[model samples]
Target: MLAIRTKNLGKEFWRQKKASGLLGSVRSLYQQDKERVVAVRSLDLEIAAGESVAFIGPNGAGKSTTIKMLTGILHPSYGEAQVLGLTPWQERQRLAFHIGTVFGQKSQLWYHLPPADSFFLLGRIYELDQRTFEQRQAELVERFELKEFFHVPVRKLSLGQRMRAELAAALLHAPQVLFLDEPTIGLDVVARQSMRNLIKEINSLGITVFLTSHDTGDIENLCRRVIMIDNGNLVIDQSINSLKRDHLAAKIIRVRLEHPVEGLPPIDGAQVLKHKGAGLKISLDTKKLSVDELYMRLRQLAPIADITIGDPPLEDIIANIYRHNQGGGEGHELEQEVAQI
Candidate 1:
């Protein structure tokens, strides 16, 4: 069964055109000139049940618009969509019963009340019986380790503690599909990993996870698939492994040497991106030279003090995709048939 599906789903808005200066401002009262701005254009997507997928893009890329349409908060300008076999806009009330949402920047919990109170409120809203609510609440509190701060006022709870409570509240009713937006935005390292583990456990229980986050760590740690969009256009939809294998041909390595050298000798298939006192950064093509091979060559040149190797930033990977798709055209259309679910 498909958890979410869309075909040619799009959204448009009309912005009132205004001219500059005081004279233009005065004339705007009499003249109403508007321009059509497309937020999402001809988007098609399919997400299978129990799949954890990341919907990602830069700012103003229509990611929020698309999510709004899916959650029935905003109606689309054209096309159609379905979430869990029901039309979102038309069946919003019923849809609300089966889906859970968590936004890192926003809070569904009551600010003045404790998380326990909010959980009770949510249970009542979701129509969960007393016995069932208590059972689920106990399970979540223990699993999320919320016993330490569960009764504290939400306003007094730390960001990490509050996020844990938020997740627990969202799951109290046992939702089938969980939509998370920047779930780990301001969390510390240990807190972020804890949240990721909880989310993974939720997905393991057969719930579909739809996540959107700018943190590459969140994407790498949680999602099995990636759906990238830009300028309100579908750019790529493929498995995470496929995305890495196809686009991540080069690996970046930054090494700190124990002692500075006069000049480091070059190695085949590796480009020295940066070199300074006791520090060197290199880009290596895995297709031409293995990482171990480059490490061996580097060891002969200088004693390594500290070294770290990983893929380039996610933004760079997306830029590479854009370059490959439109051939570096600024306004070119991305009409290529890329991978899909």
Candidate 2:
């Protein structure tokens, strides 16, 4: 069965034109002009059970809105969506029985309360049976390695620790569908890897995961399929194989010179993209230049310090995508573009 589905899903928000000052705020209550901004336009998507899918887009592109509607967190402005065979907004309680959610930026746990207390509260709210709840909770605690500070106040826990607890809380009921919104945001390398491993394990246990993340590493590592959105519209939806085939055209060559070169040596097969003291970054058309051919050409030139060749990471590719779509405006847009690395 399709674990999540949406048709013509959309969202619109009324943006008020208001000044920043307190006086302006007071005056704007009675004298405000607002416009309905389309946050997400007609978008259709389907994700099968047990599939790890990544939904990625620029800020205000409807990624969050789409997720909210699917999870029944927000009402859609138009069209319909169903998750786990239930209309998300209309049957949210029923849908909640089978779904999990984790938002990295928002903390659902109480500050002074220990995360264990928070988990206990959720168990009660979900009305999980005593045996089922305890077994699931124990499994989650061990899987997420939450014993370090399981009883400590949430405020005393570190960010990574809190994130693990939050993840465990969301999954305590052994939910079938997981919606993770930037779940690894602001996490360090080790923490991020931990989060990824947990997710992989969950999916291995037959949980279907729908994740919206700025981190392309998450997508590349965890997802087999990706759906890209822009301006609230679907831009690309395909297997990772297809995305790589369609978008990745050239490979990057990082070259460190023996000493600072005056100007990039003119090489027939590569174009220098940037120069940094002793390092020069180049892009080569992989179709036209074989590694052996380029190595031979480089060997004849000035001494080299280091050299490596690979594709520009997904972050660079997605940034270029937004640039192609929106004329290169940056902010939350750029933040999402670069967070993948």
Candidate 3:
């Protein structure tokens, strides 16, 4: 069963176009010029029940707009959408019972209250029975490891602790779907990993997850499928592995030499990105030069104490997708692939 589906879904906003300078500003009050900005365009998407999907794009890429439409926070300007078998815009109140949303920059919890108090307040909001609410709260607190700080005021809790509490509060009603927007935005490494693990565990319990995040680690570790959009248009919808395989063709080779190196030998497809005493970093185009060939050449240059080769970061892969679409190079191919997928 599909948890969420959309057909040709789109959104637009009308804003007053401001004029520059004092004279223009004075005239603008009476002469209001307006322009339409397309936040999302012709989006077709389907997410299966119990699937974890990542919806990602650069800033101003309509990622948040799409989520708002899906969650029924905003109505689409065109087309149709059904979330969990109901029209989101028309059945928003009914649909709210089955879904939960967590926005990193926004808080649903009461600022001055403890998480325990907020959980009970949410229970009332969801109209959960006293016994059921208590059971659910206990279960979530245990699962989210919130015992130590559950009684602490939200304002006094650490960011990580507060996030865990926020998630627990969202799940108080036993939602079937969870929409997470940058849930780990400000967390440190340890906290981020903890949150990821908790989210993974939650998804394992059969809730559908639709997530949006700028952190590559969140997408790489949590989601199996990726839906990428840019400039208000869908760029690609593919499995995470497929995205890495197709776009990540470059490799970085970092070498620590036994002695300081003067210069690197010229290689056709490899460029020295950085060189310092006893250390060298080279960027290699794997499509042009094989790793074995590069290694052989490096051996000939100097005695190598240690060497490590890794693919370019996920950020680079996503950037390359945007660049390809902006240049009008491989976007057509990607659209075709998305259709097949």
lDDT of each: 0.88, 0.84, 0.88
Give me the displacement of residue 165 in model 2, in angstroms: 1.0
lDDT of residue 31 for candidate 2: 81
Q: Write the per-residue lDDT of candidate 3 for residues 69-108, one digit (tens) a residue.
A: 8878899999999999999989999999999989888999
Residue runs of model 1 more than 4 Å from their true location after superposition: 253-261, 264-269, 276-279, 286-310, 313-315, 319-341
- Mark the 10 consecutive residues where model 2 has the least summed lDDT: 332-341
Backbone collision count in every prediction? 0, 0, 0
Model 1 scores worst on lDDT over the 10 consecutive residues at: 332-341
Candidate 3: Cα lDDT at 282: 90
For model 1, how does the per-residue alpha-carbon lDDT over 1-341 read when each residue is reduced to its tens digit? 99999999999887677779998899888876676777888889999999999998777778999998999988999999999998899999999999999999999999999999999999999999999999999999999999999899999999999999999888998989999999999999999999999999999999999999988788888999999887788877998888887899899999998898778776888999999988989999999999999888888978889999998876678767755655535543422222211
lDDT of 3: 0.88
Deviation (Å) of 53 in candidate 1? 0.5
For each candidate in turn, give its C-alpha RMSD to the true structure in angstroms. 5.4, 6.1, 5.2
Could you tell me how far off, in angstroms, the CA of residue 197 lies in candidate 2 after the best superposition?
0.9
Alpha carbon lDDT of residue 187, candidate 3?
Answer: 98
At residue 137, candidate 1 shows an lDDT of: 94
Better of 2 and 3 by TM-score: 3
